[model samples]
Target: MIDTHAHLDFSQYDTDREQVIEECRRNGVQFIINIGVDFQTSKASVDLAEKYDFIYASVGYHPHDAKAMTDSIFEEIAQLATHPKVVAIGEIGLDYYRDMSPRDIQKAAFIRQLQLAERLKKPVVLHIRQAMEPAFEILRRHPGNYGVLHAFPGNAKEAAEGVRMGYLIAFGGPITYPNSQGPQVAASLSLSKIVTETDCPYLTPQQFRGKRNRPDYVRFVIDKLTELFPRYSRDDIVRITSKNAARLFNLPVDDSPELAYMIGKSLYLNLTSRCTNNCYFCPRNSGFHVAGHNLRLNQEPQEKDILTAVERYSGYNEIVFCGIGEPTLRADLMISLAAELKSKKLPIRLNTNGQGNLIAKADLPSKMRGLIDFVSISLNAQDETTYVKICRPQFGAKVFPEILKFAKDCKEYGIVTIFSVVDVPEIDIDACKKIADKMGIPLRIREYASD
Candidate 1:
């Protein structure tokens, strides 16, 4: 796990800073990006980074101290940012809730640091509070800068907008608070756009709230994330959030493609990255990541390759023929692989775009009678027009009816068939639910993860 934001330089940890950092190392905290709020703290952050190979620094002026910023101080920050261990420029932005600095001064300081980060080609760590509108407006005017909205203080729509503008929304201790909006906002955005941070020596997790926040306490944040994303495991949260921090900070970490991944005891196989529809809300357009695993495959896996990948694991509730792509595109391979896996007595589920029959020119569901126990078909729209508008299938206007027919065929073959819809703005959930009810099939509403 990576604690993206921390402040060990604070006097709160003066007596046991080394012990806290050592505990973080033993608790699997891979990296920590110590933040600087002023000239002295920036130098202390640099000192910490230089002392520990696993620690990195981000130099900038906090909005609370914007009034104290001068040209020379800004230049000092610019110089510190050039250090190899200094990965980003931040702990900067407007904080109207405090109003410690004049709003105008805060704005000017924010813009200057933003310009510095842009010229330096480094990502930023924003700390906007009640001044989200102005902060976001300033960010819009000064485009081409990307980073995280640290300790994000906005609604789900704002989070989506930040992601659309190439920024990540970070959630920390507040997420674990009762009735907090963090879980809802986290659920609404793509896993790829979410990162975990402690804002340590500040927002402590609920389990240890009121106590000083430590880097190792980041695990509590991950625990809350697991509840928000029930499909993902604790380890998935660790790897995914760590990867997000690494990518943003250019930290050294392994980010290879995953062929087979586990999510809540089910092993999902990525047979291909090829898809039948180019849905507007699909993550493929931005990044082929689903539940934190990179599904962007360089090559489609063969039958033996798939078998070998699964052989290294056991105790899965089921094997899912699902990835960012339509698994049925490789129909024969899926059927053969399912037949072989059936011998192990574990059930197999297939998640598809429901164009299997159209693609194969055959009743594909009938062939998978005993092999597939459950099948989820993407009934993404209530009608053909909506389907065409959202899915934009290569097979054109005739795809929707065929998908319904495919679902019907699967039910007739004794397979548990279900209809699924992504809850995007374009989709009519009530209409889709009516269609599923009329057909006596269950409809599963999937949250739209904005890219």
Candidate 2:
């Protein structure tokens, strides 16, 4: 597994740095990202990356160093990022825990680095501690392509927010400690939005407490992760998180047929491009892409056209009811078409806004009983206020209550329910979890699509 985060640039590893790298290699640790906290360490990080194949570097000034940062420093960071192995531009963001740097300086430096990452087209490795709400404010205002929250400190509520923003949360050693409440919150999140990190020489897991951390201890993090998240295998964790890291950092990956990812081989029937909500951050307006696939819909396809598309990929894994618009808006045609696919014994997956039950004003979940193998619903917010601001639903607050009811209905019908929330900056993830847990269904927090 990749230790996507580490700070070998610190003096903590000065005595036996080479030995540490050797040990990491022996332990099957594929990669280690040595993050920089300032200009000097950032350069050292880049230098170390150049000397070793397995070690990559992330160049940025930490919040504590923000007070000393200047415009020239950003230029230097941009230049250092030109190094081939430099993967990100952070260890940036706020740290209310120390407040060593002035809040104003921290914010300015953080925003500057964010702009640098955007200009460099690189992902950031965030380090927010006891400042999620304010950190989120900066994030919402300067929503770039993507980044990760290294050692996230908020509850499931914050995790959901980060996930909605298309950011991955990197869990370090503290997760193994029995008393670490922050790590506990992270463990409860979906594996898709999580990546394991050692954050070596700091935040050591329980076993290595009071001892200097090492890259080899990544296994402990994975082992604990497996114990917490039983649905995922060790290999699955490596695959998913690595892929997410690769995507966020824009690392070139092997795209062989065996490695290429697709939700299913099924036909994805395009319904409509029009949406009821005009979310401020919706890709439909800013950038129309999903999973790197272009999703620019010019004209709506007729039912016959959709059926023809389905017939073309009939040997697929399944037929998915999905599109940029609400699939249920064409509910009549969808039910009829789904029935046709069912007759052919084709599996079906429905991606809906979950307003179908309220829109049709009927028992929609039961209507999907045998027609769908899985139903993925968008549970975008924790409360109605944020929901209105983020989703901007045409139906207003009505959509929020209706979606929750829809989740419960889907569970009762024995349909595989996926309750998805977006990574908007302000939503409460823990509250959403309470709702999902009460209803007894799986949850997915979607990353915000970027331009």
Predicted structure with the largest TM-score when compared to the true one = 1
Tens digit of lDDT per residue, candidate 1, span 138-166?
Answer: 99987879999999889999998788777
Report clash pairs, candidate 1: none
Give the clashing residue pairs of candidate 2, or none: 156-430, 157-429, 157-430, 164-422, 164-423, 165-423
Summing lDDT over every window of 10 consecutive residues in candidate 1, give the lowest-scoring window.
285-294
Measured on C-alpha atoms, candidate 1 has an lDDT of 0.91
Summed backbone clashes in each candidate are 0, 6
- lDDT at position 51, candidate 1: 95
- The local distance difference test score of model 2 is 0.78
lDDT of each candidate versus the true structure: 0.91, 0.78
* lDDT tens digits, residue span 204-287, model 2: 889979898887898888787767756555655666666666666655554321111233344566677667777776667744
Q: What TM-score does each of the candidates earn?
A: 0.92, 0.60
Candidate 2 to truth, TM: 0.60
lDDT of 1 at 314: 77
